[model samples]
Target chain A: MDTDLARERILDAAEDLFYARGIQAVGMDAVRDAAGVTLRRMYQLFPSKGDLVEAYLARRDARWLDSLATHVDTVGPTAQARVLAVFDWLEDWFARPDFHGCAFINSFGELAGTSPQVTAAARHHKDAFHAYLHQLTTAAGATAATGAQIALLAEGAMTTAAISGTPAPARHAKAAALNLLTLDARPVASPA
Target chain B: MDTDLARERILDAAEDLFYARGIQAVGMDAVRDAAGVTLRRMYQLFPSKGDLVEAYLARRDARWLDSLATHVDTVGPTAQARVLAVFDWLEDWFARPDFHGCAFINSFGELAGTSPQVTAAARHHKDAFHAYLHQLTTAAGATAATGAQIALLAEGAMTTAAISGTPAPARHAKAAALNLLTLDARPVASPA
Candidate 1:
C-alpha cells in the first residue's frame, strides 16, 4: 500500500483499540493485526508507539471538533442557539453506541504522568475546544469567563455521561447553560 | 501486621500508585513493594488486582466525601455558602502537590470498558456525589435538577483542572455555581 493509505489504516486501528481498551492495554502488534499491515510497515509509518499515539490523538481531535462544528452550523440560527447547540451535540455524541468518553481526557488519565507527548496533545485539544466556545460566547455578547464556564459544563457532561452510561447530563448541562445565558447575556439598555 | 492494618497499608499504597499513575500501568508486585507486604500476604488481603482497585475506589470515595463535608461544615455558615463551599474545597484539592484528578474519574476512564467492578464503583461514586449536592441544594431551597447541574460543574472542574494542570477551573466553576444559586434558589412571595 502507498504510504498515505498505510498510515491512515494504521491510525484507524490505533484509534479503535486505544479508545476502547485504554492506550496502555493495547499493543502495537494488536494495532498491526487490526490494520492488516505488516509490522515493518507499521514501524515505517509510525516509527514508535509514541508517534502512533500522537497521530491518533491529533486526528481524533480534528475530527471531533470538525464534527461538532458541523452540527452547530446546521442547526444553530442565532448566537444563543449556537451556544446551546454544543450541549445538544454532546447529547448526541453520548448516545452513540460505541461512545466511551472524551479520548483526550481518558488518554490524559492513562498516560499524562509518563508521557509528555500525551500531555501536550491533551492540553492542545482542550485549548482548541475552549477557544471554539469562546468564539461562540463572544458572538453572543457573553464574556470570555462565561465561555470558560460553559466549557466546564460541556466537559462535565462528557465525564458524567461516560460514567453513568447515560446522555442525561447533556440535557442537565444545557439547562444550566441556558440559565447562565439568560442572566449573563441579557441586553443592556441603550443610552439616550 | 494485623489483617486490618495490613489492608489499610495496602490500600494506601494502591491509592497512591493508582492515582499518580494509571491503574493498568501499575502491577501487583509494585503495589506489594510499596506497601511493604509480602506477595502471599498481599494476595491474602486483596486476592486480586481487581479487589485492590475496588477497595482503593471505595476508600477514596468515603474519604473524599468526608473531607468535602468536613470543609463545608467548618467554613460554610449559610445554606448558600455551603453550596459554594464545595468549589472552595475543590480548589484546595486541585492545588495539592500530589493531586492528579478525581480517582473515580481516572479509574473509570482506564478500566470501565473491561471491568464491571470499576464501572459500578464509578457510578456509585458519582451517584453519591450527586446525592450530597442534592442535600446541599435541598437545604438551600433548590430543585433536585439544580443539584445535578451543580454536580456537573464540580465534575467539570475536576477533568479541566487535571488536563490544564491548574486550579483556575475551580474558581470559574464556583462563579457559575453562584450564578445558578442566585437564580434557581430565590425566595417566593407570600400570599395576601
Candidate 2:
C-alpha cells in the first residue's frame, strides 16, 4: 500500500483505540495490530506514537466538523436554524454506538498538560468551533458575545452528554441557545 | 498513622498526580512515593488503582461543592447573585496554580469508557452539580430547565478555560448565565 493509505489506516485505528481506551493505555504495537500494518511500516509512517496521535486528532477534527457542517448545510434555511442544527447533529452523533464525546475534549483531558502537540490540536479544534458558532450566530442576528455564550452551551452539552450517558443535554443546550439567541426579539417559554 | 489518615494522604497524592498528569500516566509507585507511604499500606488502603481513583473523586466532589457553597453563602444577598457566585468560584479556581479543570471531567475523559467506577463517580458529580444549579435557579425564580442551562454554561466554561489556558471563559459563562437567568425580565445588552 502507498504511504497515504498506510497513514490513513493507522490513524483510523488509533482514533478508535485511543478514543475507547484513552491515549496512555494504548501502545503503538496495538495500533499496528489494529491497523494491520507491520511494525516497521507503522514506524515509517508515524515515527512515534505522539506523531500518530496528533495525526489521528487532526484527521478526526476535520472529519467531525465536516460531518457537522454537512448536517447544518443540509438543513439550512436560515442562520438561526443552522446555529441550532449543531445540537441536532450532536444528538445524532451521541446516539451512535461508537460515539465517545468530542475527540478533542477527550484528547485534551488525556494529554493536554503534558503534550504541546495535543494541546495545540485541541485548541485549534475548539477555536475553529467557536469561530463557526460566532459566524453562524452573528449571521443569525446575535452579537459575538451571544455566539460565545452559545459556544459555551454547546461545549457544556458535549461534556454533560459524554459523562451522563444521555443525549438529552444536547436538547437542553439547544433550548437554552434558543432563549439566548431569540430573547432579544420575543417572549420565550420555558423549555419543556 | 491511622488507616484513615493514610488513606487521606494517599488520596491527596493521587489527586495531585492524577490531575497534573493524566490518571493512566501515573502509577501506584509514584503515588506511594508522593504520599510517603509503605507499599503494603498503600495496598491496604486502596487495594487497587481503581479504588484509589474512586476515593480521590469522592473526596474531591465533597470538597469542591463545599467550597462553592461556602463562597456562595459568604457572598449572598440574593439567590441570583448566589447563582452567579459559581463563576466567581470558577475564576478563583482557574487562577489557582494547580487548577487543571474539574477532576471528574478529566477523569471521565480518561477512563469513563472503560471503568464503571470512574463513570459512576463522574456522573454522580455532574448530577449533583446540576441539582445544585437547579435548586439555586428555582430559588432565584427560574424554571428547572434554566438551572440546567446554567449548569451547561458552567460545564462549558470549565472546558474552555482549561483548554484555552485562561479564566475569561468563567466570566463569559457567568454573563451567559445571568442572561439565561434574567432573559425574561429585561434586555441583556449582548453580554457586555
Candidate 3:
C-alpha cells in the first residue's frame, strides 16, 4: 500500500478498536492485525502505540468537528438553529448502532492518568468544541458565556446518552439550550 | 480486623487508588497494600475485583450524593436555591486537590463495555442522581423534565472539569441550570 493509504488504514483500525475497546485493552499487535498491515509498516508509520493513539485522536477530532459543522451548515443558516443543530446531530449520533459515546471522552477517561499525549488531545478537542459553541452562541445574539453554557449541556448529553444507552438526553439538553438561547438570562443570575 | 472494619479499609483504599489512578491501572495487590489488609482477607470480603468495584461505586454513590445533599440542605433552604446548590457542591468537589471527576463517570468509562456490573452500577447511579434532581427541581417550581435538563448540565460540568482540569465548567453549568429553572421553557421548543 502507498504510505498515505497505509497510514489511513492504520488509523481507521485504531479508531475502531480503541473506541470500541478502551485504549489499554487493545494491543498494538491487534491494531496491526485489524489494519492488515505488517508490524514493520505499522511502526514505520506510527513509531509507537502512543503515536498511533495520538494520530487516531487528532484524526477523529478533526473528522468529528467536520461532521458536526457539515450537519450544522445543512440545518442552519440561522445561528440559533445552528446551535440546536448540534444536539440534533448528537441525537442522530447516539442512535447509531455502533455509537459508544464521544471517542474523546472515552479515550481521556481510559488514558488520562497514564498518557499525557492522550490527555492533551482530549483537552484540545474540548477546547475547540467550546470555541465552536462560542461562535454559534454569539451569532445567536448570546454572549460567549452563553456559548460556554451550551457547551456544558452538549458534553453532558454525550456522557448521559453514553451511559444511559439512550438518545433522550440529547433532546433534553437541546430543550435547555433553546431556553438559554432565547430567554432573558440577566435576571436569572445563578448562585455560582 | 473485624469484617466491617476490614471492608471499610478496603473501600477507602479502592476509592483513593481508583480515583487517583484509573480502575484498570490499579490491581488487587495495590488495593491490599494501600489498605494494609492482607490479600486473603481482601478476597474473602470482596470475592472479585468486580465486587470491589461495585462496592466502591455503591458506597461512593451513597456518600457522594449524601455529601452534596447535606451541603445543599445546609446552604439552601429554598427550593430554587437547592437546585443551584448542586453546582455549588460540584465546584467544591472539582476544587479538591485530589479531584479527578465523578467516580461513576470514570468507572463507567473505564469498565462499562467489559463489565456488566460496572455498566449497571453507572446507570443506576445516574438514575438516582436524576431522581434527586427531580425532587429539587419540582420543589423549586420546575418540572421533572427540567430536573433532567439540569442533570445533563451537572454531568457535563463533571466531564468538562475533569478534561479541562478546571472548576469553571461547574459554574458555567450552574448559570445554565439557573436559566433553565426560571425560563419559560414552552416557547423554546427544540428542533428535535
Candidate 4:
C-alpha cells in the first residue's frame, strides 16, 4: 500500500483500538498488529506512540465535526430544528455497536492532563460544537448570553447521555434547549 | 493505628492518587507509601487493588449521597429546588482545587467495561442519584417520567462539566432543570 494509504489504515486501527479500549491501554505494538503492518512500518508512518494518538484524535475530531456540519447544512435553517438535528445525529451515534462514548471525552478522562496534544484536540472539538451552537442560535435570533447557555446545556446533555447509558439526557437537554429558546416573551434587545 | 483507621487511610490515599492520576498508574506499593503503611499492612486491609478501589468508590458514594440527601432536606421540600440543589452541590465540588471531576465518573471512564466490582459500584452510585431524583420529583408533584428525565439531565450535566473542563455545562444543566420544573403550560402531559 502507498504511504498515505498505510497511514490511513494505521490511524483507523488506532482510533478503533483507542476508542474500544483506551489510549493508554493500546500501545504502538497493538496498533501495528491491528493495522496488519509491521512494527518497522508503523514506526515509519508515525514516529512515536504520542504521535499516533494525536493523529487518531485529529482524525476522529475531523470526522465528528464534519458530520455535525453536514447535519446542520442538511437540516432546516430554524434554530430549533438545527439544534434538534444535533441530538438526532447523536441518537444515531449512540446506536452504533462501538459507541462507547465520546472519543475526546474518553481520551480526556484516561489521559488526564498528561498530553497537551490530546487535551488541545479535545478542547478544540468541544469549542467547535459550541461555535456551531452559538452561530445557529444567533441565526435563530437569541442574545449572546442566551445562546451560550443553550450551547452549554446541549454540551452537558451529550456528556450525560454518555455516562448514564441512556438517551433521555440528550432528549431532555433538547427539550430544555427548546424551552430556553422559546421562553423569552420579548425579542432580545439588539446589541448595544 | 487501628485496622479501621488504617483502612480509611489507605482508601483516602488511594482515592486521592487514583483521582489525580489514572488507576492503572497507581500501584499497591504507591498506595502503601502514600498511606504511611507497609505493603503487608496494605494487603491485610485490602487484599487487592481492585478491593481498595471499590472501597474508595463506596466511601465516596456514601459521602456524596449523604450530601445530596442533606441538600434535598434543607431545600424546603420542593422538587425543583431539590433538583437544582444537586447542581448547587456539584458547583461546590467542581470549584474545589482537588476536584478532578466526579470520582465515580472518572473511574467509570477509566475502567469502562473492565471489572465487575468497578462497574457495580459505578452503576449503584448512579442509580442512587436517579432514585433520589425520582423521589424528589414525585414529592414535588411531577409525573414519574419527568422525574426520570430531570435526573438523567442532571447526571449528564455533571459528566459534561467534568469532561469539557468548563463549569458552564453544569450551570446550564441546572438552569434547564429549573426550566423543566417551572414550565408555564405543562409541556408534555404529565405521564400518569
In candidate 2 chain B, what residue range of length 10 has the lowest lDDT sum?
Answer: B183-192
> Residue B81: error of model 4 in Å?
2.7
| C-alpha lDDT of residue A192 in model 3 | 44
lDDT of 4 at B79: 56
Q: Which regions of candidate 4 are displaced past 4 Å?
A: A185-192, B163-166, B184-192
Best by lDDT: 1
How does each model score on TM-score?
A: 0.95, 0.93, 0.94, 0.89
User: Candidate 2 vs candidate 4: which has greater DockQ?
Assistant: 2
Report the lDDT tens digits of candidate 2 across residue range B1-192.
888888888888998999998888898999999998999999987888888888888998999899898899997669899999989999999988877888888888888778889889998999998898889888888887888899999999999998888988899899889888887455344532
Count steric clashes of candidate 2. 0
How many Å off is the CA of A186 in candidate 1? 3.0
Task: Please give the TM-score of chain B in predicted model 2.
Answer: 0.94
- Which candidate, 1 or 2, would have the higher lDDT against the true structure? 1
lDDT of 3: 0.88
Cα error of candidate 2 at position A13, Å: 1.4
State the DockQ of every prediction. Answer: 0.53, 0.55, 0.50, 0.30
Model 3 steric clash pairs: none
Give the Cα error of residue B11 in candidate 3, in Å: 1.2
Per-residue alpha-carbon lDDT of model 2 for A75-185, expressed as tens digits?
Answer: 867888999999999888877787777888888888876898999999999999999889889988988888999999999999998888788889999999998888644
Better of 2 and 4 by TM-score: 2
Cα lDDT of model 3 by residue, B1-192, tens digit: 789999999999999998888899999999999999999999999999988988998999999889988999997578888889899889989998888878888777777768889889989999999899999888888877788899999999999999999999989989888878766333333333
